[model samples]
Target: MKLPHPIQYQGSKRNLASQILQYFPLDIETLIEPFAGSAAISVAAAYNNYANKFIINDLNKPLLNLLELIIEHPNKISNNYEKIWNKQHINSVEHYFEIREKFNKSKDSSLFLYLMARCAKGAVRYNKSGEFNQSPDKRRKGTIPERMKKNIMGVSSLLKGKVKFKSEDYRLLINDISEKDLLYMDPPYQGVCSNRDSRYYSGIDHSEFVVFLEELNNKNISYIISYDGRLGDKKYGEPMPKHLNLEHIEINAGRSSQATLLGKKDITYESLYLSKALQKRIINDNQNTLIMKELKYA
Candidate 1:
């Protein structure tokens, strides 16, 4: 099924969502995303009925607000987006910069959506002063208003009453997690765009993230993390510690766009880490499946 993704975000797991979600248990009360970039996984889960409820949280307040508007007031956002998008046809480059400046000052959700739609490579980069600074994609205009409306409304219909939005630190959000909740994390890549990763408001400390994972394990929480991977021979970020007792799975994320542009063939493999608790649940579920097959054959 084609999932509705109104916002085009860099490092979104939209393409890899189905592969990641195959590991999800049959029943999930809530799916919590602490670093919900575009909320790709949550949207996919909702469309596929993998989770009954979702908590989409991000430290980026403007992005979170944009998502809220997309889900709550699709028509309002779509209409505002059409006005902004239509004006860009007269002078795409200049119009984009004007929208970006206004968004930086007002932090308006509608302006944020237009910026995200037209930004280069769908990458979100912020200045040190916390302003949207990514340049617009010059090759073409963003998604058409008609298609954008379709995506926005499609997403709203699926997630209208099923999602809760949060704009807080992940640590604070994780403190209230219960066993029934399945947390899916897609934190910013550690070494991407310099050591500090200007793409995010702040980069996560590698050591500190490891400690956070340890705490989740200690609590016996079920979780899945999409962290660190290899691009051909080069690897990005440090692998999860073995002491965490997590199961590591490599997902083929297809070719590297950068490599392809450079006339090289490099396949990207993203790392997917499953908590021991979730792994055990999968095993039991698999065992039951085999038993059911045996009973049917008998």
Candidate 2:
């Protein structure tokens, strides 16, 4: 079974995780994710027994804390989550805002997860002042508490003793990578989503991130990057430097949900960049030949 997370994330790799995992080295000692939003890839890796150990890190402190709570105390968090989720309130929107206010003040993980689940389209957005500003989803009743409880338990079980979660910058996490480690990075879409979505990551330095990629290249680290590929006629994401020697592969993600919500149907394709170390490891064979070709020129 696939590992499922309780909260919804904007750029989650849930659908494309299997495809992405195929590009990674099968006999990896450690699997590390620096910008793990919902850690969908890590969850998939753990569930499928892809690595000996998993390291999931994110810059989002509250979200990381919430994930930790689910790992350590799934039952307790689920009980509290059900209580807030099943409340027969006067107005759902007003009640959502009330919970949001409480979460902001107390930084409660359970309330934060509930807010994310009940938020509009599960779109994680923050204001210039670093406040959770997304509105409530009026069309749906959100995910059921029991269903989320099961997902939480599943993730916790798969990750037990084999996973480590941290709230840290991507650079710091990348610096800790060893030769036997495989890294998967899913950073923010700078120019792409900022036009439509609020800046989810506060004060992120894109140029510095490029420098980290250079460091990884110099060290010959095995890694894969999921970056913005295309939206209609426009290309998105930071343009990679040729010096990095990273192979590109595009994954068709069907229609953009955010664009659809805004009354437009635009096809979205995410670009996956495989580092030179991973590229050299992709051997020529009947089964792997097709995947290798897709990575060479895309």
Q: Could you list the CA RMSD of all candidates, in the order they appear?
A: 1.6, 5.1
lDDT string for model 1 (181-259, tens) is: 7999998776653455567866677777888888888888899999899999999878888999989999999998899
Cα lDDT tens digits for candidate 2, 42-95:
888887878858887887788888777777778888898899988825688888
State which candidate has the highest TM-score.
1
Alpha carbon lDDT of each predicted model:
0.90, 0.80
Lowest summed lDDT window (length 10), candidate 2: 190-199
Q: Residue 31 of model 1: what lDDT? A: 94
Model 2 residue runs over 4 Å out of place are: 192-197, 258-266, 284-298
